[model samples]
Target: MTAGRAAMLLALSWNMKMEEEIKKILDNKPNLRYVVTEVGGKASEEFRGKIIKASMNAAINKNIIGKNAYESHALLHALSEAKAGVTINSSMSVSFAMKVAIVRSDHWIAVAMFGQSAFHPMTNHERGGFGIMHI
Candidate 1:
């Protein structure tokens, strides 16, 4: 498989594992809620707005404020950076970046994935899904 496909598969696996872990944690604390949102396609204004709206609605339904909601821009940036082989430090793996982004966000509302190929301004891949959630 191509490197990009391989990376995407690995990311999917990692995300699945994370979902399991998050589930366990949440199970222990029913008072807390975890919202995992995904937006896959070229990052457009409309797509971003959709994610923002989804996140806002989720937060409001859960009685949360704007500050408590999280966006996945940092995660997307880290994935891009990792794919580009840009490392900030020795421990700056893609997984590390993802964890950091999630922690910083606290309540991630969006996790946008752009492009199937890792090419610059990745094009050709058909847009798939918008503001998907795994809550």
Candidate 2:
């Protein structure tokens, strides 16, 4: 892997280790089926790489489905049965993760928000079902 990619992977691992609280939250939610982290396009190529790798790692640990390709429909199916979701898109920021999680969860899995405030651009009315955690 490129140095940048390696750095991202390391960073992601570090974040995972550091965020034990978050992991605990996920573990508590038995219904949660998947955890997603968006690979933001603008957040440096290295960060994006980290996001993807981190997401894969989270998937393995959480035993959830990780979508790296054409599986939107399948993802949605999994989301419907899931307890929670984690997304890392800068477009809507981490808050969007809450939106995505809430919309997809069938068992009311708690949502954990991460990322920047810039994600706030996403309004509640546009998508609906953001009852999950805000941050």
Candidate 3:
């Protein structure tokens, strides 16, 4: 693996291990599916939005069809009835990780509040959602 990729993986593992609060919240649930991603780049907001949305769809799709979601209109016979009803994902500023976790479900997660986010502080909206937490 590339050094950058390896570093990111290590950082992700470390965060999962060190974040007691997140572990407590998860409580080793056997059903919920979660994702970890990084979200800071020079790309346009439109691009970022699409990436976030697609990632969510793909994660959920994999849970059901045993493959990536293709936005198919045809009926997909369930390979497995099991799927996550709710999804949880997290992003943090570490060696390499998503800057923030974005969701369309109209809820906020974690300590950051950035662009187009409902939660805010006395700062630029675009610069919002960058709150740093150990979790």
Candidate lDDT scores, in order, read: 0.33, 0.33, 0.27
lDDT of 2 at 51: 42
**Rank ordering of all candidates by TM-score, starting from the highest:** 1, 3, 2
Candidate 3 per-residue lDDT over residues 20-128, each given as its tens digit? 4443444354432233343433234443454355444543454411233331211121101101101112122111113222111111111122222112233212232
Give the winner by TM-score: 1 or 3. 1
Ten residues in a row with the worst lDDT in model 1? 93-102
Model 2, range 43-92, lDDT digits (tens) per residue?
34454345445544554455444344432334333332221223223342
Better-scoring candidate (lDDT), 1 or 3:
1
lDDT of 1 by residue, 1-135 (tens): 222332233234345676566546544654343334343322334434444455445444544333432333433443344323322222211121121111112332222232232224333322222122222
Pairs with steric clashes in candidate 2: 31-83, 32-83, 32-84, 33-83, 36-86, 38-88, 83-109, 92-119
Candidate RMSDs in order: 12.0, 12.6, 14.1
Per-model TM values vs. the true structure? 0.35, 0.30, 0.30
